[model samples]
Target: MKTAVILLPGLNRDRDMIAAITHISGEPPVTVWQTDTTIPDVDLIIVPGGFSYGDYLRCGAIAARMPFMKALKEKAAQGVKVIGVCNGFQILLEAGLLPGALMRNASLKFVCREVELEVSNASTAFTSGYSQGQIIRCPVAHHDGNYFVDDATLKTLQDDNRIAFRYANGTNPNGSIDNIAGILNAEGNVLGMMPHPENLIEHAHGGVDGRALFESALGLVAA
Candidate 1:
């Protein structure tokens, strides 16, 4: 399956994401610059993690206005699959493709370490390879990964099974409400998470738990 990865000006993880994709799918994902106004036809699109526009104004705020994001928004409306990791998740929130905002760590510090994430919803294309409530190890490195939303919206997300992942073992490193580590759109076509699955694709890096995410997407595209 063809996959496209959007690269923002300050993106740092595009190549890592590409490596993970190629490792699993045996094909290099196309890299699309943020300034590009068009998106190529692909089964999946990934907004890789990075400090887009140097995190000016706010994380992902500036990059959200890029031309390519407009095209991404349009594609999302047509049911195309999209995944956003770390800063990419922040961009998705800024772009209004997903709800809630990422705020500074509750402790007001940057956090970098392996974090345990519980798969809360495995029915989505992104998490289908994992079992619900299964715990996976992944790396999270961010100063503003705390996710916040109004209580009502949180309730809606909980009721609809949109809360796809949460910090496992009561480890809320960034003070995210209810330990939320990731979420999926109501339609389950878009997924945004704070952890870096790409960083965990190789056992040499730590573990291979992240391979499930890519495999799940490949399954969707193949289907």
Candidate 2:
């Protein structure tokens, strides 16, 4: 699939994301700057993990208002797939592309390590490579990664099969409401997650579970 990575100031994991997508899809992803108001036509857009804008006001608060954020919303309306990892997920919430918020870790510490996720709804475009109830390990590096949503919203997500991934038993790195590690927007075209799937695409990273996501996107675009 044709992919582009959003490059924001203080974005830390841009190179890692670029490398992983290049390796998984066998195509290099272009990096688009935050200041840009327009994005190229592509099958997918990725907002990778990083401390955008130095995490001054919450995690992704500053970067969320950039012009590209608006462009992304437009692309989503056009049915272009969008994936946000870690801080990118926070931005999606701030931009109102997704519901809920990412709160600070319950421990209030920067959690950086590999975590296991139980695939909740594998039927979506992003998880077609995974199986329902499959557990995949991916690294997460962030300070504010706890996912939160009200009871009604949470129930709506559950009833709609929108929860993408949940932390494996006892693997909830942060105190996310319902241990939600990832979720899909109402249309299922947009995905926001805290874990860094791109980090797990390389064999050297100890697993290839993340490849399923990239492969799924490619397959979806091909379809």
Candidate 3:
């Protein structure tokens, strides 16, 4: 399957994400610069992790206004699959492609380490490779990873099965409500998560838990 990986200024993990896609799916994702006006022809799009715009106003606030994002929003509306990681997740929230906002960590510090994530909604294309309640290890590196949404919106997400991943084993690294680590949109085609699945794509990185995320996307395209 063809995938397009978008990179914004200050983006640091584009290569890591591209390697994960190439290794797991045997396809090298096309790297699109943030200034590009057109979204490439691909089955999937990934906004990789990084300190976009040096995290100036906010983590992803500036990057969200890039020309590429406008096209991304249009593709997303057409049901194309999109995955946003770390700062990418923040961009999604800034662009209104996903609900909720990522705030400064409750501890007010940058957190970088492996985290356990529980699969809450395996029915979505992003997490379908894992069974419900399955725990997977992925690395999270961010300062503003605290996810926040109003009670009413949180209730709506829960009702719609949009809460896809949560901190597992009762550990809330960033103090997100209900330990939410990731979520999907109502349509289940878009996913945004704080954890860096691309970092765990190889055993050399400590585990292969992230391989399934890319593999799952391949399965979705194949089906």
Candidate 3, residues 73-152, lDDT tens digits: the string is 98999989999999999999999999999999999989998889999988888877888889999888999999999999
Off by over 4 Å in 2: 220-223
Residue-by-residue lDDT tens digits, candidate 1, 1-223 = 8899998889899899999999888999998988899899988999999898999999999999999998999888888899999999999999999999999999898999998999999888898889989999988899999999999999999999999899999777899998999998888899999999999878788689998999998773344
Worst window of 10 by summed lDDT in candidate 1: 214-223
TM-score of every candidate relative to the true structure? 0.97, 0.97, 0.97
The predictions' CA RMSDs to the true structure, in order, are: 1.4, 1.5, 1.4
TM-score, structure 2 vs. true? 0.97
Expressed as tens digits, the lDDT of each residue in 129-191 for candidate 2 is 888899998888889998989999999999999999999978899999998999999999999
In order, candidate lDDTs are 0.91, 0.90, 0.90
Flag regions of model 1 displaced more than 4 Å: 220-223
